[model samples]
Target: MKTTFQHVNYYWDKKKEKDLKNDQIELFLYRSNILGKDLRITNYGGGNTSCKTIEKDPLTNEEVEVMWVKGSGGDIGTLTRQGIAGLYTKRLRDLKKVYKGLHDEDRMVSLFNHCIYDLNSKAPSIDTPLHGLLPFKHIDHLHPDALIAIAAAKDGEKIVKEIWGDTMGWVPWQRPGFDLALQLEKCLNDNPGIRGIVLGSHGLFTWGDTSYECYINSLEVIETASEYIHQKIKKNNTVFGGEKIQSLSKKERLEKAALLAPVLRGLCSSENQMIGHFTDNDAVMEFINSNDLLRLAPMGTSCPDHFLRTKIQPLVLDLETNEDISNTGDIVKKLTPSFEKYRQEYKEYYEQCKHKNSPAMRDPNPVIIIYPGIGMFSFAKNKQTARVASEFYINAINVMKGAEAISEYTSLPRQEAFDIEYWLLEEAKLQRMPKEKPLSRKIALVTGAGGGIGKAIADKLVKEGANVIFADIVENRLREATKSYNKDIGSYILCDVTKEEDIKNALNKTCLDYGGIDIVIHSAGLAISNPIEQTSREDWDTLQNVLVKGQFELIKQAVSVMRKQQLGGNIVSIASKNGLVSGPNNVGYGTAKAAQQHMVRLLAAELAKDKIRVNTVNPDGVIIGSKIWEGDWAEGRAKTYGIDVKDLPAHYAKRNLLNEIIYPEDIANGVFALVAILHKSTGNSINVDGGMASAFVR
Candidate 1:
């Protein structure tokens, strides 16, 4: 017998009918946060919820009713008052009827103008009417993975009918907004006793007379689905055979193991412990070790919300032939074939789906795949990404196994998945915000841009909408980095900042090519260690020439260019926290950097007449392996300190409140702040240290 969904209407107990306390509101918000983080249910600005706020209309001499729904770009996990946009119920319903057939953009603008809520809000949720359509005071809509898993199958309609029964109605997937709402309205009219709705390839909708009841109803529907599938798919799990574990000798392996502890820790750390559990679990191992890998293919996640917690897919590893599970060997040799096969298959799928609306192929990076016999691997910029991929893999595993047991589990045509995976509209959705908003239309010049902090600062400026000329002594490295950036966003310039003639030529060439420079980030410096006892006079000359004198020569020439162009400019020098707090090994560099910061303040005050604002960013212990962190410096510093090189990243990263390592990118973001805020205020030194040095932080 197929299990059916049953809706139980809940009400506040008479004894507990009093209004919720402040703590209760926070508790509710926290749960909302969990749901938002999981992406198992919601996405960027995709879902909405509202609480009834009744207030008296002073002029009208009557009570008014409204619901404050979340605004655009708001995620429930990080919601604030600014995220909510108030709407008058009477006016909203009236517009919903008359607003039929308008383009979504037009409909949205009309709603924004007419809605008697907050006038300052940008855009209301696309499902505003659906939430309003329910008579209940509280409403929630999420695309649950379990629900979508059952919804996307060949027998989905039958299974959903049997499970949900008459509690709710199901509508095949339609594009969201007016069309979806129209279909939903018709379904509700046809089934007056309907408790809620399930949208195919979308998500679930639930509501109640109160907020708690609505939340519980949403939870119950999925919990029952999970139980039904779990019972149906339970198997006699067994471990499959793979390569036997090979033990390495203590001395060498210990060094390698220590080198790998950070990657391992990242995989098994807090916020990512779920990956450790999934990889170590027997079912996942057996699944990976299977001869027929497709049999264990992940069922698509239960809902859209899972995407944030669980990426769109997981890697299916072939454990027997897998390499680099330890992250030591050539990953290229191990993953090359798999990468090629994925790309070939992906290209064919794109050809099959080549409609005018089809998008170009995205990076062939397989979000999830098995390494023949190894468990799995997930990819993201950070741990949160891996966590999301792991969750999707687990949920998909359960769904695929359950559906296969019931009947042949049918996968969506690879083309349909391609259409979604490479959808232009979906990609366009991400283009909603520019990567560099703070530095729009700004032109930047970065010294020492061939490596380390200079390169990082240049990249940061380019990300912030600044057209950058990355100046450095190494012409080849400068040109090599230019390939990674859009030609329109950045370019390379070879100039020795310490040479006044080289500085003048580079600035003149840049201004001639790209109009005028609006910002400059000076990061060129040379480091030499000699205790006062062993110090040499020549070492001081090189340090002064690169650190203090270099910036001064560049700024003097840049200011002359700025004055001729009649435009205000901003300059940011990358000084060190070591310049402020004394470190034992420093001899000459710190003194040079200390003088550089003071020069910045003096220049900021003098340049006020020319509208040029000067500031300096001081960062502490930024290292290589980052675009800005040089591997040589890390090794040199480690040798100098007489400690393991691997330990230095953690050593430097932990000297802060957050106990996180600082990156050159962190320092780059500081440059962005100086340029962004300098239009309003000038002549300030902003410390990007992990709280190591405290001067005025304006």
Candidate 2:
């Protein structure tokens, strides 16, 4: 309830605007944007709005009364005129008689769609009947976190009556259907001049003669609710202190997170589907480290709407209390039983509430897992959904916290939760999701991803559906790279490969965000040319840090994660042609790479037993976009070979037998082959130099 109104940048398609405004749909869309962007009013997809209007009948030119209601599966903030379905007002209200004692969701939808006032309009919201039954020209319904804090309270009814006086109506919990609509209509009729209606364990509904009135009504109500909760928390002494202390400190949590993520990911991997976990943010850390987490987290989500994404309740683990927390075996042993207990408890709950022919119960596995001293993991069928679910719960945490502070948090009863979770209306919305991409749930961490070759490789992997972490020293570029990707598909960290602390923190971040790294593409290295006789000691050490020592450290950390999960993984090094066959002035580049190449082979020999494949993609003339070959360095290289800088690329390309000029994408393709398809291939060098016969080892 710290409220501020931010105007949305909007424009008019003059002709369309004039037409829509006359129908009241234009005002509906503009106000919807106002609500959608405000987090306190609605979180993501948890609200709806509508307007009563008139449209002309095409054939008769007769004015027809209609209700332009927000459609199913659309966010209130982003709703447009198309997103607002125009349903025949009287027709929709009259249809409630047919559905009166029925819980037939599919039948209800079919009838609703059939009564569209405009055939071209989008599907109306599932709660259209609720809005239609109301007498006002405009209606605003929202699951605002603050309002939910009041509605989901133990004595919610009493609190509402006290705060708003008898000017508000109270409707007890009823599944959203024709009955709920009828019950709401009855309540509003009984309380003649009510400002709003409060649905127990649900949300707020306000209506008015105009859009502006309804929007302001919602804001005032939310402010009152938020003020009540704020005072309650202050009185109870339950407000969150800034950054609470943890049993296992941040460093220790990162350490455990590195070990635990892969194991969880491995256990959750099977079939064509896989799951990744998101646990890196400050909100998750605060919740996990809090003292009352165990008691409060098990209480459930703020609303039943979250049941599908978060499960009935998260599985909680006390990692700090376990003996040998460092031993992943001990951690795994504890988690196995915890997961089973959660699964069994869910099954019992499902059986207790399921109707005789309810749809197949969702997988009993918990979607959210709370492990204090580490963090909470929100797992899902794909990376994007997993990420969205993670954010959804993070937002819910505040609402739950508010409810807990005001009164013992109250979620919908178990039977009501089951109805929403299994409703055919919701199930159809879920089924509409398109098929997963080939590499959909695979997690990859790519170093040097801010620019050049590393950027290209990262892009290719994303195209194949991998969730990628782009780690680079270029902070600005790295930030932009993460922004380009869907938040679920890509993220970044500023990293200096030569620094152990940088590498460690980056690894921990990847572990926390993605469960573990399936593919570690080591692309962080430099190319320098200096004669063996003239190479300075400083230059030698600098290049060596990047190529040899830095790569070794990365492998060391990655293997530790792979070993814990006991799942086979891939490590790829981007070595150069100079390593295989040193050119005249590439002593620094050649020496560092030779050591790095041999180190990859040695790692392959040792890690093969761990099912960790190690390989190299060596490209001789991938000069199209490689930053290593830019500027005076290329001129210097051309001078060494007694050729013009302009002709340098052709010289290297023809030196290869294939006569084709290789590109960064070609090199990426080779790396993709090794990591994605070459399961039995390890300790191998795949040359992407169009076929460099001289550099070819075979």
Candidate 3:
């Protein structure tokens, strides 16, 4: 809330020849990024800003004043001029006449479309009316948690007045609509000198002739509100941490939290499994473990903007007996019935409010889980959203603390929550979301994902909407590979797939993190080019352990979990063409791969009854982007072919009928097809080596 406005930077040139509207938009875009940078001021897409400027009406050939507001689907942090929609200001103001006679929101939207200054089809924000109604050149409304702490408390209006004196106007919680805009306009007109407005159970609004005035007004007002709430809480405070319970070390707290993570993660699983771990700082630990959680956690989100992100209520873990909290097995057993109860309560709530015209109810699975001992875990379809939910709820925790210290913490009731949760405009936005990839909801685990074929597989799986865990013995390599992919959908597991314990741990994590595995790809392999005469026991042992033994452990653990969960899965192995054909100086690596290929056939037959589809992708000379095929191995293979190391790829292609050199990504496509497309085919070997004559198998 402190004024850090002077240091914000953006590149724009006033020398450029353009209309005044261009200047207005450039300034707004720069300011929007500045405001959006700090989540304390405005979260992701939860706020809107506007400017009134003149744009030329193409049809009428007249310059007309218009209100350009942050449009729908626009993220202010990365907004462009295209993200703003210019609406004819006079025409929009005249919409008071249209809204009076019309009650249907779709028809109202059509009328709003008619008021667009240009043919720009981007829809304005849901709060555009608030900006349009108020007579200001620039305006902003943000849902800062500090402001909400004061706004969401009982007698919030009186407290707002006490803090802002006569400078701020109050609007009782009115659902954002055309009517609410009229009410805000009326309040502003009545309070002639008011510079700001605070909507009860909502957010703060400020306006000015210039962007800085409106921006600074918001900062000063929110600062005042923050100070007031902090002061009030300090005076009446019963400190949750000061001289209270016995303190546990960070390691102890983490150990305790880790014990419960899998159980909670498993309970929250649906068609797709959720991944979570312990996230605790002093703020979270102090707030979550506080005595006020029982009273403060269930009252709901401090503002409606969060309703779209966090649902109506959180699932408070009902560890019935004290012993359940300490015993991992007991907690796991207890979560089963508790989650059912939570789902049923949510179902009843859904049925209570749903009308024929209402949008379909979202899955009853709780998004936020209140864990009394550690901290809260917020569940979402992917990691990024899960993190966002955790962040917003963390902010809510502090706000609730402040409110409980001063007065009773209260947010909107269940029906208001339902209304926001199923809002037509919001539902439309979700409906408009792009179609998900083929493997959108499926969970995948890939080994040796540090680079080469495994990395390619990981990238492909993640791109197809599968949450992929990239595992390797090299932690740094795994981290580097995972970092390049979308972190939201990809994660890294550092473990040697060759180890039995590591394989078991990886499988356990997959099931715990994602509910159950849908697809598990075993791409970890080792190649050592050595003649039987020169091959030592150590070299031979390493190759067999990684290629043959590692594949066995990976699939064995995956199928065991898949069977228990009763959800059939897909298993894939990366078998080499050298396994199918005889190659010179190939003793240890070739035989191990040959064993892996045959194992796929045997397991496919055995696990077919369990509905698990098992397959192998046999690829040849896939040297492109492979760490294994780089220095010594490439030179060794080139020596066998009597060619330059760089020419090995082309040499293999010349021997193939298609004469196209295969890449690691070509192998990835074949793997994806087996799991996602070739559902009916199993016990199969799909070759991705451009029709290798020797390796071709029926």
Candidate 4:
């Protein structure tokens, strides 16, 4: 029977499939990628797909049935041949002889390595037995929200029977291992000709003789479940017992989110500093403002994949529909107690559930926080992790909506969740991860980042693991500069630093984008070389507005955000050697640079109490890759020294004590050292000018 779906899309392309032709492995990858493309099908890094293929054994040159399945920690959407583990199917099935019982399921995982069909294959996932034991050429195990909704409902088994009848079978929740694999095999035998089975409180499994048929079967099951759930939802009068609080305007929501994110970030970073992501989308806003938010949020998520990324449950704040958003002081006063309570409860959970061999308790801070009438804030060790956590919660919210529409939503058992969370295998995996970079979890905002020294500094910060915001006045320049960097690690904003509103908006965006600001690099600058006699009032004022006043505005705004986080920050000003050494035809530019330099020292003393360090990096004659040396300034400086502009670099090098020519990268290195290396040396000035004696700070 032909069926249409409103909730899921048909992504199987006949043209694309034709290209794969008779390659069964390629067809399997095609089906897996198309299924993974939709979040409605499965979330990032969540499902596994497999195909049993007959291939020549590498050692014996004899044909053997081998199973290629998406491996551990692999995302099916981006799966490659290398990402799939190849296991001899007969060997895997033979493992049942050695499987002592349910208690020895984890040990069974170690034996799968012996079944390897390809020596270079990736490590198999825990779900290997679920696919390998099934008597089908193609199998799909997915965590679609629609299917998960039915699986997580209190009457999930009854609902599954009502939707698919005898065509789809049902199995009770069993942690993925040899035991669950055996249970699935039994379910298939008992159900006769069932097309699929719903794994209670987990996900769905479907299979067929071919990859195309398997893809279609998985979609038909998910689509039918979604239609049934949506029909029930339409009949219901209210979801989550209807909305309790009216959502704020989008602009107002963002304003409130910015105000709260830093404070929440600071509080959560008590153990380890966290990067945060904020979302006020319709799904998040609807759930947070619902009457049953308080009742439903603490029940936690049913899916293991969802909770692992989002934590067991989000910390929901108690706030009125029209809570005050003028300042964060009152909000902080209110949230502090709630945060402390959450930590205590988490500790108690560990104490109550700890096994003798359990790993030590980890950071107890909540990964997610729900602010009523506002939105959701998710935190993790990096930007991508934080962002993905927010997306997973949105999926959880959808599952809850669909389940609550028909039957009461049920969360995974607390003890069971604790077992999976603190599982020894999971702990070992965590330990295997590489150590974080020195600048990891740090967020930086660099002005004049479109090109030249600013671009260099921004690139350096990103390389060292900081999420950087490239702020510049030129849109095209900003776009070109940011196109090469990943969105999670780097982004750009239009900020004419001379404007207070621009500076304020940039800082607000930075906080909202990556949680909070840890480093501020003031590199946006301009130079006008002219004698005192030739310098006009407008020219002098222009230099002051951009160089001196621009630095003032950016720091004034960035400091507010940094203080809110209470996570001591760094501020480095790209000052000039011209500020210190007296030179002719440089009065306007020199005075502005001097002001920029002194401002660093003044702020250093003022902000030191808050642990906000301010410093300066002075550069002289940075001829190559410097926007300042592009036009009139270069010509004027060359003329003053009686040298051609082409020979200016050589002349400047000769003038310096070190006889070295400075470049933009050298200036960038200076900034990197001041922020990342010179943690204890703030209020200091480092000259990147190849050592000019007259310009030295003494």
Q: Which of 1 and 2 is ahead in TM-score?
A: 2
The list of candidate 2 runs beyond 4 A from truth reads: 1-27, 80-86, 117-123, 238-296, 321-324, 373-375, 382-384, 394-408, 581-584, 653-658, 677-681, 695-698
Residue pairs in clash, model 2: 36-77
Q: Model-by-model lDDT, in order?
A: 0.61, 0.77, 0.76, 0.91
Better of 2 and 3 by TM-score: 3
By summed lDDT, the worst window of 10 consecutive residues in model 1 runs over 269-278
**Per-residue alpha-carbon lDDT of candidate 4 for residues 1-698, written as tens digits (9 for 90 to 100):** 33356788788878888888869999998888988899988988998999999999878999999999998888998899989999999999999889999779778888999999888899898999999989999999999999999999999999999988889999999888898999999999998899999999899999999888898899889989999988999999788899888988889888888877899998899999999999999888888999899999999999999998998999997776467745667777887899999999989988998899999999999999998888899999999999989989999999999999989899998889999899887787788778988799999999999999999999999988999999999999999989988879999999999899899889888889998899999999988999999999999999999998999988998888888888999999999999998989899999999999999999999999999999999988889888888989999998998989999999988988889988888988899898888899878899888888888677
**What ranking of all candidate models by lDDT puts the best one first?**
4, 2, 3, 1
Runs in model 1 lying further than 4 Å from the true structure: 1-31, 34-48, 52-65, 90-116, 235-287, 290-292, 296-334, 354-361, 381-390, 405-428, 434-698
Evaluated with lDDT, which candidate comes out highest? 4
Q: Summarize candidate 3's per-residue lDDT along 168-246 as a digit string, tens digits.
A: 8999987777777888999998898898888888888888787666667767776667677678767875644332233
Model 4: runs farther than 4 Å from truth? 1-4
lDDT of 3: 0.76
CA displacement after TM-score superposition, residue 494 of candidate 1 (Å): 39
What would the per-residue lDDT of candidate 1 be over residues 1-698, giving only the tens digit for each residue? 12233322222233333433423333344445555664445443445666555666655867777766666556675766666677777777676656646345334434644765666654675666666655666667765556666765567767777877888788886545655666777888888877778876556777766556666676677666656655555542322223233323334333332232223222222221111111324445445555444543544443443433443444443333423444323333354465566556656656777777565655434555444333444543322344345556655554455555444345554445554455454555556754635665466889888877788888887776667888889888798767787545677878887799888667654543343566888887767655777568887888889888898998997776565434568888888776776666676877888889889989988999988999888887776434433445566567777878778888777766667778778888888877885566676777776776343343
Candidate 2 overall lDDT versus native: 0.77
Backbone clashes under 3 angstroms, per model:
36, 1, 2, 0
**What TM-score, computed on C-alpha atoms, does each candidate reach?**
0.52, 0.87, 0.89, 0.97
**Positional deviation of 575 in candidate 4, in angstroms?**
0.9
Candidate 3: list runs displaced more than 4 Å.
1-22, 101-106, 239-266, 269-278, 320-333, 473-486, 491-494, 499-518, 552-568, 599-613, 680-683
